[model samples]
Target: MTRSEVRTVLLDAVRELRPEFAGLRLTGNEHLGAELGLDSVARVELLVVLEEEFGIEDEVDPRIFMTPATVNALVDQIVVAEGVCR
Candidate 1:
């Protein structure tokens, strides 16, 4: 999938998981944890949603959630994990 497509999917999943974020214009730069206020639980939920949305079954690396993460970074990770060529 293209970056724009990945961004759209990520935004949709994030909105579903966090309705408050629905109004925010999510640039790829927004930090998933710090800026978006996603706690550990929310991050996990987001990852689960992303995995389900993309039909990804492989276990995600826990380290990815250990620190602040950005939308672009997460999308890149998902695209790689899903084995979708850019």
Candidate 2:
């Protein structure tokens, strides 16, 4: 899938985990944990959701989920890795 597609899927997953951020704007520079106030539990929840949605067993580091930009960047990397694996 393209980066845009990955972003859309990731955003949907995030919204599902945090309905409060459903309408919030998620830009490349936004911080997922700090800006959205997602604690460790919430971050794990998001990872689980993303795993299910993407259907890939990713080695998602906790630090990468610290921010929206980081998450986006990580997802991009994961998509490439998964594509390579496929």
Name the top lDDT candidate: 1
Over all chains combined, what TM-score does candidate 1 have?
0.67
10 residues in a row with least lDDT, candidate 2: 77-86
Off by over 4 Å in 2: 58-69, 77-86
Error of 1 at 23 (Å): 3.2
TM-score (C-alpha, index-matched) for candidate 2: 0.60
Global lDDT scores for all candidate models: 0.69, 0.62
Model 2 pairs whose backbones collide: 32-68
Compose the digit string of candidate 1's lDDT tens values, residues 1-86: 47677578767777777788888787768888777777788777766765676676455564564454887887677556545536
Candidate 1 Cα errors over 4 Å, as ranges = 78-85
| Residue 2 lDDT, candidate 2, scale 0-100 | 61
**Per-residue alpha-carbon lDDT of model 2 for 32-84, expressed as tens digits?**
66665667677667667766665755655545554444556756665554452
lDDT of 2: 0.62
